[model samples]
Target: MAIELKEYIVAFIDLLGFSAMVQHDCERPKKEHRYIKVLYTIHLKTKELKKTIIGLEITQFSDSVVLAIPYSQENYKKVVDVISNYQYDLLNDGILCRGGASYGKHFSTEDFLFSNGMIDAYKIESTIALTPRVIISKELIDLVYPASELSKNEHLILESDGLYFINYMKNGNADDSWKAICKAIPDELSENPSIRSKHIWLIDYYNHQFPESKRKDNHRFVSPDA
Candidate 1:
């Protein structure tokens, strides 16, 4: 089989408590099988996602997963669908994932230009400690064109790169309690006036895999007022 080189949108999804999961297993090696089960499930889901979204490739390293997609709105939309479906399965099976994605030109070669998109995604994921949510780049939001507009739940808040806050539609509306708990942050930051760009992200709690305390990663980002 020959694989051709192409452009891609790279996404780095770091699970918040994945290190804790590994550490917990390290401290108690007897329960390693359970962690293996989780990893296996992730592997299966990644494969399925790849099959569903053409030009998508994924690999997992211990507690985190990296997904790459061909740079196109259609493919990115499918990627989002896969993420949403994965979230559904996690919720039904009692698991939560703190995920983040950035869309930009990526290559299949050794040399590539690394930017703040990846760092920002990780930072946002870290900042949401104790919460289950997916943080995405502003560049992505401009590309998503859903057939039917979804309703924004009270738990959802949209914050731009310049730190301007906007109330936007939520892709999924599962629980009212979840909405209330997630949407408690005020819109806008008066303290930091040196922000730029129009990028924003969606944050919420998954309630299935983890408690709210697991998402903080010591990153700096203005979060909703608790």
Candidate 2:
């Protein structure tokens, strides 16, 4: 006989810039130290939120966390609220989040266990750019009205499938966070011959993702949330 299973909501929460943070730390490893500390804090906060918010079970991976929650009306709101709150708190620390939430079915059989409907959720999530925000599938939007608590940037939009993805970027309150980041880099390394090559690569990445106008206005767009 096949084992019974139930529908569920899968929440994918991915941390942004873990590898970049480490790779760029050669000049000043202390900066990386600070980044790791912030990550740990975020982890603890999410775990606490899971316990406080009913019907949610939080699981963590190397640079991400996936939460499987009971599929229900109230549970959906809880998930959104928790994530929004999480992002809001991290903004001050210069850390942002990219995440997706969708309801699906988790199957359990005699010889196998698997999930369905999560594929759509992931598809919707893929459309979100590197910003702090939540992306919800069309099915989820139809079920509950999204709150206007967070503003959407270029990465936020409604897909053809009617799924709505919102990218939230906020200004970080950390003192000289960006400046401190730059200061940590040694001038010798910054002026290295290979630095030009890396800058070119960075430019290519930005150009591919952002329009020339947005790229030129670096002051305003350097950080989406800011």
Candidate 3:
């Protein structure tokens, strides 16, 4: 069959600490079976997301998941919503992830995946998205929502470094997920020091985006125990 290349918005997501999650379980006593729960959780959550979200094609392997959608305003919006929700859901389950979304030419199918779109998304996710946030490529932003319109968009925030990341806390009710992510930072900092700086950046961004007033119950930070 001939390869069919087309424009697509691709998202590449990596589960943070996945290797550690596996290693920790591997080193445990064989009879303890602690890793079963982690494996089950990942399976359940991915299955749930796939069933819940539509209009996108997904390919998942080990700690990475790739989602692709045909380029369109509606499709792009769905991509953003699915990715944002997936990130938040994972955080609530004590698993953090980072990813990148880009738009370009690509070929993807149930059994095969290849393209510059995938390459761009992977590069951004591995290099740029060091935190538990899905960084949107400027190429995607320009293709989906031009700069003039994005300036007034509340769901997306342009950081000081000029990269645009989704403000998952937007629309008001996502506060709980936002708080959960903040609460997870300290624990992740110790577990994964390589991304410590990115975690700090995420915390700073969260504080700036949701100030004391915007925060519920007059709390600046949620208790890790809570």
* lDDT at residue 106 of model 1 (Cα atoms): 49
Candidate 2: tens digits of C-alpha lDDT, residues 157-224: 54344445542222222333333223323333344444433333333323333443233222312566
Where does candidate 3 have its weakest 10-residue lDDT segment?
212-221
* Candidate 3 lDDT by residue in tens digits, 65-126: 88887788888887788777777677666677888999888886678788788889999999
Candidate 1 wrong stretches, greater than 4 Å: 1-7, 29-33, 109-120, 123-130, 143-226
- CA-lDDT, candidates in order: 0.49, 0.55, 0.75
Error of 3 at 66 (Å): 0.2
Q: Please report the candidate that would top lDDT against the real structure.
A: 3
For each candidate, what TM-score against the reference?
0.55, 0.59, 0.82
User: For candidate 2, which ten residues in a row score worst on lDDT?
Assistant: 212-221
Candidates 1 and 2 compared: the better one by lDDT is: 2
Number of clashes in every candidate structure?
A: 12, 6, 0
Please, what are the lDDT tens digits per residue for candidate 1 over residues 1-226?
A: 3445454556666543456556776677684534556756766776677677767776666666667777676776667666656654544333445566666544443334343444555565556422445555555554553323323422223432332111222333445334433333224422432111111112222322234433322224656873
Worst 10 residues of 1 by lDDT: 193-202
lDDT for position 183 in model 3: 52
Better of 1 and 2 by TM-score: 2
